[model samples]
Target: DVAMPDAPARPTTPELLPPNRMPKRGRGGSERGRIAMLHALAHVEYSAIDLAFDVAGRFGALFPRSFIDDWLSVGADEAMHFAILDRRLTAMGSGYGALPAHAGLWEAAGATAHDAAARLAVVPMVLEARGLDVTPETVARFEAAGDLPSARILQRIYTDEIRHVGFGAKWFGYLCANEAIPPAPRWQSLVRTHFRGKLKPPFNDSARARAGLTRDFYEPLAAE
Candidate 1:
């Protein structure tokens, strides 16, 4: 038999996610920007569900066992979210691919893929947390417009998402404490450095405050 040398192992970098989960941009780039944004958001939420499951399964000891349960719930919720958006789009005679969506959310996920702390920072804490802040306006708009069904659904999503961002805050704090990163300031700095978008003002303080945001986190943000 011919001798064969061992194959070199592949490196997993944040710049590129695992091959199967790589995010492709341009799924929703077009005139129907709102629908495209909806499509993109649903897909990213779906992807977060996958990340949650992996963490729950592979690192059970590191994370509370229930983390898996939480992620699974989020997964189910994401499916519903996708379905809702899909149905609405279809009602308008358009669908998920009808427009173009840049892969901003998943690109950030990829950026922090190599480190769990980074992942937690970029995904749940920054991205999903933003959802909590922004969702109330969406919900209120639905209510004002007499879109009761949308309002109801948005209410549920907003509530559950608060807990999800709370998970990020909890985990982020825990990781910082363990790593001796001086939890508070470090968290503020990391979120600021990695997150580029200015958090739009007239923000949903009540919803965000409910979602485990500390005064430290919001005060500076309010100042901005």
Candidate 2:
């Protein structure tokens, strides 16, 4: 087992801002707006690569080999997602570093760094599951703007993210069972303890169910 870094290295550009300080990203209604949206998405994917690897490196020893295998595969997927998004940004005449991004994405990782179960609960189950919730409409927005290539990229990422969340849910259940705890309430408890943000609704129930993250695990915590 290797040591995990407290944070991932990032490029000097794309000055990071607090989420509240970040500029509003309107719908992809114009070229500039679309670039902003894509850039932000690229940043998320970039950060996710490190998040996946950190989980493997930091907590892999506590779980089975399959755990390391799954998270490493997730890291690879995140890397690919970032690469394609960065390429798309370049094709659009704007690159990832051209705009500012929020640093809040990594905060979830920091909050749950101590426990693998908590990490799994908050990162993939809550954070990445959120991607499942919102990505369809984001794709539709790109399609509405006549940006088929970008829309297709998001669609592909959305599909891969289902499996990623599944990995998290699967292993979290494994951990819960080992400790003689019920999976759903254990997940909810971990999330409530480690997650900083509210569980917003309009959730994609079908996609979440496909990931083994059913309403039982999250619906109780949904924001009213």
Task: Please identify model 1 stretches exceeding 4 Å from their true place.
Answer: 1-41, 54-61, 221-224
40-82 in candidate 1: lDDT tens per residue? 5555555565556544444445666566676666667667776
Candidate 2 lDDT over residue span 1-224, tens digit each: 45788898888988999899999889899988899999999999999999999999999899999999999999999999999999999998988899999878798888888899999999999999999999999999999999999999999999999999999999999999999999999988887888878999899999999999999888889843
Scored by lDDT, model 2 comes in at 0.92
Who wins the TM-score comparison?
2
Candidate 1 at residue 80, lDDT? Answer: 72
Q: Estimate each model's TM-score.
A: 0.71, 0.97
Predicted structure with the largest lDDT when compared to the true one? 2
Residue 215, candidate 2: alpha-carbon lDDT: 90
How much is the lDDT of residue 108 in candidate 2? 84
- The superposed Cα distance between candidate 2 and the true structure at residue 132, in angstroms, equals 0.4
